[model samples]
Structure formats: C-alpha cells, structure tokens
Target: MNERNSASNNGLTSLSLIGDAAEVGISPSVQQARLPFTVRVVADDEALARALAVRQKAYMRHVPDFASTMHIPEKYDREEGGLVLLAEAKLTGSPVGTMRIQTNRFRPLAIEQSIDLPSWLSGRMVGATRLAVEAGGPGRMVKAALFKAFYLYCVNQGIEWMVIAARTPLDRQYAALLFRDVFGVGEFIPLAHAANIPHRIMAFEVGTAERRWREAGHPLHEFMVATHHPDIDLSAAPSLAWPGTSVDLQIPADPADINSGAGNAVRRQPACTL
Candidate 1:
C-alpha cells in the first residue's frame, strides 16, 4: 500500500510542477501571442508608397518642413543594397509604421559623410533611417515589431553593427535599448547627411545583442531574444551582406535622394523597445 501511495504522489508532483510552470508563462506557445500588425519588406513601389505615407504622416506632426517632401519614396528605397520595412495593420491593412535600412556593402553608410567610423565599425554595418509610426497604441507595438525585424535582418545578413542617428528624446530611448554612443556620450553631432541636424549617433552590436541584453537583464530581453515573433516578416528582404563577406557591388544611378530624413521627427514616447 505504501508503494502505491508513493507512485501516486510522484505522479501528482509531476503534474503540480507542470501546472506551476504554466502559471509562470514558461511555454513559448503561451508567450508567443500574435501581434495586431505585421511588419514586412516593402515588396514593390505600391508598398513603398504606403510606407512613405506613414513616414510623412508621423513626421509631419513633429517636423513638417522635412515631411512635406516625403510624399513619395526616397531613392534608397530602390537602391540595391538597401530595403524599407513596413508595419501594416492586420485588420485594416493600413500602414502603421516604417523603417529604412541601408548597408555599406557597396558604398559607405550615409552617416559616413558626416563623421568617419572607427576601424572596428568600418565594415559589415547596417544603418536604419526614416523610422516613424502612427501616434497610438498600435504605433507602439508596431515599433517593437519593426525592431525585431531589424535585428533578425542584421543577424541573417551577418551585420556586425546596427547604426542610427536619432534626435532629442529618441536618443534616450536608444540608450535604454543597449545602444551605446559611437562618439562622446550625450554629445549630439551635426549630421550633414541628415539636414545638418544635431543628432546623437548610436550603434548596437549585433553578435553580442542577445548576450548583452540577457546579462544586463534588459526589459525587452525576452521580447527580443526569447519570444518568437512571427509578425516580423523578412521573406522579401534583400541580402545586404553574407556571413563572411560583402556581396557583389552594384552601383545604381545617383538619383540624389540620399540626404533625406536620417533624424526623423516623431513625438511618441519610447515604449517596449523603441
């Protein structure tokens, strides 16, 4: 009778442990809920237009002078070594947010025009620009989803560093995301490529992003590294650089839209990942 009781207690203990784990939301299936929107590569001119609209709308609220000319897609949108990501509402198909990513595979990064990068950051770099999202709850979520896509793209392309020039207030959020200043901390550099705006240049190490966040106990650590976000789609993304080297060089015509909004104007508070 005691042997049977011990077996029964063992079974109960196993069931109780599983129940406890479930309560803590340990399963990926439980944590991996769907996002209200989906972020994907801008496939064609039409999709690019939608992304541009989102950019203009979000920027106009803060920087009307720059946003006025953003009605159409920028030259980088069609560039060989660059791509634009768009987050669209799954229910309404409206563009919720957008971010433009360009690499230095063929030419130097846009920020290079302003300041020279150190030897460590000279190669295999991806820069993000024109990041904007609608002003609301959906906008916050869209920004997080877009960043996940950015991180995944960098990983797939073997990008060493992710760089960006952010304006005031936005720079603080970037700091929270584990982005360190490439130059002097808290010093804003005037980026000629970004309309001579005094913006802070920040970079995130792609290879060490997961480990750094985990070690630091970052708030978005789980959302970034642990959770599997299916809403971020990179299927149509152009390959910027491979694991070991840069791809074949392709120089497009100098369409002359390079010096656009690097320091995009958005008034939204930095939410989940910013």
Candidate 2:
C-alpha cells in the first residue's frame, strides 16, 4: 500500500470528459498521469457502450480470455436501472478510464439470487456489486471515482449503510471510506470469500461519511456529494425468525437504481443533505 502511494506513475492522460485541462492551469497530463482526475456519469448509449468497450480492452490486456467479459447493455435508455461512468481527457476529449454501478438497494432477496440474506436477518445496510474499473491507467484513481459515484448514489437514496466484496489492495482505503470487514459488529452473517478479493463489508451514514471526508485528508471529497440518487430506504427486516438456508429471505422495500437513466450521468442535486 505504501509503495502504491509513493510509486511514481507515468501515462498519457486524456481528460476530454470535463474540458478542464487548460483551466486547472496546473497538473498537466504530462506531470500527473495516474489521476486526481474528474469523474463523469455516462448517459448516451453510444458513449456508455464505448466506455464498456474500453473497459473490455483493459481487462483483456490483463485478465485472461478478456473477450469473455460480458458487454453490459444500456439500461437507462430502456427506463431501467444501473449506471456507467467515464473519465475523459480535459484537453483532448479522449476517454481515459471508466467504471460502473448496478444497484439493487431495496429489492427483495427472492427477486435476485445474489442477495439471499433477508433484511431482518441481514447485518449491513446496502449491498453493492459489479464494481469493475479499467485496470492500469491510474487504476486507483479511476476506482476511487467509481466508488465516489456509488457513494453519492447511496446518499441520494437515503442509504445508511453499504456492503461489498472489496479487493484486497483496497482493504485500508475502503476502511477509510467507513466499510468494516463483514459481520464485525452486531449480530451479522458473514459472506464467504470468493474470487481473489475478499468481500469487504462496509456501513456508514451519508452525513457521517461527509463529516469524515471533511475531517480527513481526502481531496476528492466533493465527488462524494456530486451525484444524486432518490431516497431508497430498505426498511430492512430479517427474512426468517432465525437463520436457516431452506427458508427464503425477505426485505419489503424498493429495489435500488439498478437500470436508471442509461448508465451513469452527471447529476446536479441540491447539495447532498450531508
């Protein structure tokens, strides 16, 4: 972790997404390639497709049989859920890196196989999955931006807690973001680790998180409040009176912004109620 922070990163920057390269009047692409880059929500299907395509490229470059990565179709255009994000070059309008968000906040456990634990039986607040960022090319910054977008979405949705299977490299960073290892507090059920990364668990109130960002050393704190998600409370409750695999779990609440507004897009909200 220390090496990642101290290691000098070199790469060609493309900040075309924000058109702020010349204005920052500082930190040209040449000097800083790893990031501190702006985050943008992708709306156009064409653009979203392009972002996913770029992610495929990066994934293929590293992950074996990269072509197998399923291409995500635009859900927003269909009046659905899910979000896509992009990082563009300020000077060139070129796409640099991207990430995505596919939430199912208040959905019932039976509706989706991924979420089997019932609310009352569950421990955390929200469950987040499909957090894929383009590898390399300032990967950490790109990842942080993706997380920021998701954070704002959760806040807008009135979410009080968040859950995830965080990559090991991000253990400390996620901890800083207020995500605790699974079932560490209160009566909780732990998710078994799968893939190479452990399913890192986290929970935090939006207002509290905002305070932490304010009182901390993070520079991208503003990103935490930029996006807007409608109030999405789970009204969570345990599915069964006690733990049992045979019984189906249940949480009577609205599912999250799974396929909303065509991938991810810039959201201007009346300041995050942080």
Best by TM-score: 1
For model 2, where is the 10-residue window of minimal lDDT?
Answer: 19-28
Q: For each candidate, C-alpha RMSD in Å?
A: 13.6, 12.7
Q: Between which residue pairs do clashes occur in model 1?
A: none
lDDT of candidate 1 over 116-193, digit per residue (tens): 887767657889999898886556557766776787667666667898999887787678778999889888998887
Tens digits of per-residue lDDT for model 2, 90-145? 45655666655444433332113333543533432454443455455455555654
lDDT of each: 0.67, 0.42
